[model samples]
Target: STWDSQGEFYESEGISKESVKLALKGSKMREELFDHYYAEGGEEAVSDDEMVKYLDDNYLRYKSISFAKTKASTDSSSSATDSSTDSADAANEEAKAKRDEFLEKAQGVSFDDFDSIIDEYNDYVASKKASDSSSAADSNSSASDSSTTSDDTSSVAESDTSSTASDDTSSVSDSTADSSTAASDTDSSADSSSSAPDPYANEKMMNYGTMDDSQKDTANGKILKEVSGMSTDVATAYEDDNAYYILIKGDVKDRDTEYAKDNHEDLLKEMKSDEFQKKLTSWVEKLDIKVNNKAIKRYTPKVVYDKQTEYYSKNNNS
Candidate 1:
């Protein structure tokens, strides 16, 4: 109501109340959807369309998939088997081979089996995290017992500097930071958040359209875009800085018509811009035209202004 009484002020400010209303309306919509989702059984009862729309609106839901790398003993599996440089090269190749094998396995996974796979994947991740954490604590205990650097699984320290190659809702990373002889890292009471094993480190849960425009131009983003276009039935392969990925896109809903209508003012401005000047001039020249200069001069300025407002109000809605 205040806006109605202060039309000139709004015109001068150039702020669209419709856009503000839409932004604020998001919270209410989320609350309603939460109620709606639970009213139906959380998973089985939710329709395909409902899931698609929820994801399209950027909710943190995803199809959880496993990504445990298979260990096949290679000829130079250990550094002692060869020279230092050669051994390191062999280890890298072995890791790549294992990662590629998992990617291949992931590509064959059907969308229907995704729901069934979640429990197994979750259990594996939870166990791996527990084991890594136990190993770290034991290493720290031994180091403290006998004043020495804890050279146990550097996985505890590695997680600290892991690359953020995952867009999973759980936010695990895939980097392997080198363990240093620094005594500070040997503390059994190191920050739990830093030492905790990343949830998606050994699993691959695929998310969609999570990257910004800048990321889309990168090799990572380009590959993700390619996966987004594929059907959910078939998985697609990609990789980032520290990890390989096998992702399949989720179902998506069409763009909202109501949302598009929010940009009608922009559309109107573009149509009236200088780029259309020649076409507009041609339309005016070809169309029937009339002048009422002498008759118009009889009406007051306020009456002419009211008429102009009425004309725009009718045309704008159309």
Candidate 2:
């Protein structure tokens, strides 16, 4: 009886026996049902027996069609959401990769290097401040002393002239007083000149030496060669004063030279090793290198022009 009622309802709703059968024949019944309903108009007449049979055969099929459509719409919405999430994830991954690259570039720099630079800078600033303060005090003291000397000179001149004028009325007194006044003026002038401080005496000369530029270059080269273990000629040519090179020569010289002979190769290997660089970086971080009394937390040395050229040439070749 329920089947019969459903069949009547189907007939009223315009679903036919053939349409019901077609819809039942495939999983894509919702699409087929819409096509069939539209094709047959809003209502299609059907026999009560045929309608009852159709309803009995495809009742679940109609329900399945409805469910399928809802599922498809939900699936489309989910796919769109998933696509957005995937794009976001890809963007995040790209950003993370860039950050990792930056960190890698920043690696090997130690806190000691920063500290060393900072300390050096701070010391330089302190020295400058002290020098400036001393200069100021010296200038102020000189000014005060100059004023007092001028006043004393004026008083002496006034007293000497007054005594001479008074002595003019009495011949012996005038002559004696005039002579004494002249002697006093002469002595005072001499003393003042002798005691006067030379302003230029405190000023330092800028020139370090009279040695020619070529001689200076040669001297610098020798120093660099001794410190860097490079050829004297090459040192002269390149003028490398890197601390790494200096440390290497100082520390590794005994191991590599004929003087040491033993484990020369091993020592050389160690000097040029990454381990040495790491150790140096660690040491620098610990020492906290300061330049001009300023603390340096981070610094990157400029790549040598030769190295940059080599890198570009290699990349181009590749």
Candidate 3:
């Protein structure tokens, strides 16, 4: 149709009217004539066949431009997809790096150090017990001296008495001596009882520093697991002051004497501190744990044992 239209336009120009009519007579003949005309330069004196060839070449050029535009669009889409994929991969890698760093930090702690500290505390308790016993012994010696002086004073008073002074002095002196001896015996018994130190104090104090490395590792693992599994709200709450208080309680309770001597009101105040809870929650989060249903359902005996040991140690020291 385009070729016929071009032939009509050529005839209206009044040049080669006969050739244009012959060219349009058949499609095959027109195509062959157009090729032969195009072989020569497209000059002003060009034949109708040459003009048809020119128009067909222009059409091919337009098709090439369209094809180029389609190719560019496809390439752009592919590049965008690749960029998105690369970005996602980078983000995932960063997340993994963060997780690994947190795990490493948590795993670095040693429970053996904690145990050694507890041993030092136990030694301190033993020394304190010895000092208390010494003080008790000193007090008893002073009491004994005062009793002896009182017995001598009573004997002198009887010696200065009237008629039965000799008999009274002897009888009174004997009774006074007997009373003094009995008083000394009673004081000695009291002193001995007071000087005896608590048997469990040293043991309890020792527990504070006695955690094993394996136990600590296990605990660190558990903490990370828990943090990983926590919901946003619960995790936030865990990092608050309440959690810190629990850790402090666990720590202080490990020292038996300190726990016993510590005021209940003070403990309550510490427990209520927001900072303590926040510290605890932060610590737990730092563990970078992820807990699943299976881990929760199956109680880990080693963890339980460590916890119980910690509690016992705290209570003993307290």
Candidate 4:
């Protein structure tokens, strides 16, 4: 009702009479009020830098109320936890005293004799396991005898049925023989059909250079892209996982000698096998295989890619 007269100013400034009253209570309250104003202002709010400057100027006494509240909360929580811990410790001490008194009353009590007690328990456990195993074996033996008897009865019945079936089979054999001749005729036809010419027969001798415009596709039917040194004479064949090439040597169609000469300007200056081996050895010698001792020890053997062969022989072989 009071806000109706000053409603326009209150709405624009985002400060009602109730809010102003609360804010005037203390500097902390005023800062809280400013926070609410900033949040609600939206488009009417001042720029962030201007807001910060204004807050700095006006709220000089607003000494981080959030920090104070947080510190108070942490202190109270710690105190409560410490009190609970103290009570629990007292309870535990009382329980321990009662246990010690009970133990003192018992005669010939030796805590050090636990090892012997454990050994006896283990022996009992082993005896129980052995007893269970023996019972299971006896049960299995009885089951096996019962199964054998059933199998024998079934076998006798099967023999009688088989004898009857054998008579029927004799009759069927004559008809089967006629069908076998028909199947043999079908097999002959299939064999003749299989003798059809191989589609890839032309591709075996066909090299890239000798291939016509229409036949310039790869073995898998991909379009042939021209490369300067890749000649037609080199017969490419693939089998298993390996690519085999037959290098044809001739006067004009000499792929090996001419291609090498044309493609490589310094073909004569190529590295020899011994020289390459020496270079490889020198490069390998320069390599620093930094084996981190801590790192190697941290991981399990299974996790490591390069496991020692002896580990498998020792552990898995057993």
Candidate 5:
């Protein structure tokens, strides 16, 4: 027996120290006073007094928690809260009813029926192109009809100024030049009129080594990065913020090798030039470099005449 803080001999044999530790481990309701009473650093039973205190404290804590919960429930069951909840419920029901009515009109959406729908658009563009060609032919026919009116007008002018034939010819030349210039300025360039632009033009054969973060995010870059590992004909259904897309991968070619064959030397030269420029800039910034303004001005080609005169002088000397 040991004299505790209470100065009493509290013996224990029912609960082991290991049992108390295990109970405390699984419980939030712990009395650290138990540690003060019987928590020795060895295998021994907790004092019966400490065990009694632990159970009593846990029961008191449970009662207090239950009282707090009951008070909260009573406070929250007020008329205002109930009215707000009812209003929210009514709003949700009304929104659901409207959605149901809309579904009745749009005839209910179906899953597993969505696609890129690009083929239909391509067909529509081809039809429009054909119609535009027919319209252009009609416009050319109208222009041909206008030319007959111009012929009669020109004859009338020629007759009125019969003696001044040279003057009339000069006037006609000026008029023709103005009309041609106007036509040249106003006429639209022949639009591509292509049924479809090359889809692969934007994504074919990336030089992935030179790509930066921004480049990796552009030109279907995200899609290409994924498909780079996949074999041809093994595609993925990809989606983004705007729309869903089905990426059908094409045959792999050593386009990178072919491109490097033609352009590797030029690319290397450009890289070397860029690196040299960066190094030069860094060196210039660090070094005490002052420009000889007099020398620069003396050698500077301010104008072509300034250099041309020297060239002429050299030629004269030679």
Candidate 6:
């Protein structure tokens, strides 16, 4: 038995003296330990230097992080075992149950039904793109007009403020220059408008009505671009009670890709539009599905613990 600083006594499993030797030799066991630690910590997992120090300083803690959860499930659960693992299992099961229920409800749905939904979503995207483009064009036109107005006002002010004949002549010259500048600005705006790419190119929705049998087969089960205003990649469809989902696999435009990268969270939030979710909620409610929370909580990961701890004394030294 070993007594911790908390005055709690627990059964002691003696340290494995071969741990440091295995780690130094780059053994497969040590690699497995690193994998567990990485999985637990994700992108913020300890660096190589910090990992060595961590292994040396808290060898038992490292072992617990690696294998304690597995051991607890096989053996009886102890107060020392993390309770959060139970909650994680419950959450995962709840999500899975919801997805299963959704799948069940979606069964018997036809390809035409999926097509209609996708078409509606694509039309919405097209309308939004058109509105945005119009607004931008209007803004540019307004800015150009405002600049021209400013130049006209300045010319009138120079003529009003003039006292000498030379100043009056200068005012006339300024007015002529302003007219030329305004003309140049108009030409530039026209040139830019002509060069501008078609905003509707990426915004065009797929027409299911025009698709042939081969095209339909090719288009099915592909990833759709997020710019389509559809939140899900797959459209649920089934034939004769067999569920076969079709994925929207459309090419993503460069503009949409850049926008998604710049505003990832915002784009996601937009994708989960209130109207789309309300429809989803209505469909789920119609199914009258219910989940078993108790059953979900009962499903936890099987745990196994390793009794090897080679560096017990190494903890205090660090």
Question: Which candidate leads in TM-score?
Answer: 1
* Candidate 4 structure quality by residue, lDDT tens digits, 1-318: 546665544544445688655655665653454344333353333344443332222111100000000011123587886775675445444433432333333224232222233234235435545665677667666666677455553211111111011221101111112111111111122234576743211111112332344443432111122221233322221111111111111122222332233322122112122344465578778999687898666555654433344444444642
Answer with 4 or 5, whichever has the higher TM-score: 5
Candidate 2 lDDT over 1-318, as tens digits, reads 333545544444345666666655664653344334322232332333333332222111000000000011223588776775675445444433432433343234332222232233235435545665677667666666677555653211111111011211101111122111111111122234476743222111111122234533553333322333332111111112211111111112211122113222222232233434465577668996658533232222333444445655755652
CA displacement after TM-score superposition, residue 262 of candidate 4 (Å)? 76
- What is the lDDT for 255 in model 5? 31
Which runs of model 3 end up more than 4 angstroms from their true locations? 1-109, 148-318
Q: Sort by TM-score, best first.
A: 1, 5, 6, 3, 4, 2
* True lDDT of residue 291, candidate 6: 95
Model 3 lDDT tens row, 1-318: 544545434433333656555656765663344334332342223343433332222111000000000011223588886775675445444433432333333232232222233343235435545665677667666666677555553211111111111221101111122111111111122234576743222111111112244432443222322333433211111111111100001122223233323322232222223434465577778897877878555547665566556655755652
TM-scores, all models, native as reference: 0.35, 0.14, 0.16, 0.16, 0.27, 0.17
List all candidate RMSDs to the true structure. Answer: 19.5, 49.0, 50.2, 43.6, 40.0, 32.1
- Candidate 4 — which residues are off by over 4 angstroms? 1-109, 148-318
**lDDT assessment of candidate 3:** 0.31
lDDT of 4: 0.31
lDDT values for all models: 0.43, 0.31, 0.31, 0.31, 0.34, 0.32
Candidate 6 regions with alpha-carbon error over 4 angstroms: 1-109, 148-318
lDDT of 1 by residue, 155-189 (tens): 32422111111224222231221111011112223
Ten contiguous residues minimizing lDDT sum, candidate 3: 61-70
Clashing pairs in 4: 209-232
Q: What's the lDDT of the predicted structure labeled candidate 6?
A: 0.32
85-190, model 5: which lDDT tens digit per residue? Answer: 6654454444334323333332221211111222332343355456656776676666666775656432111111111112211011121121111111111122
Higher-lDDT candidate among 4 and 5?
5
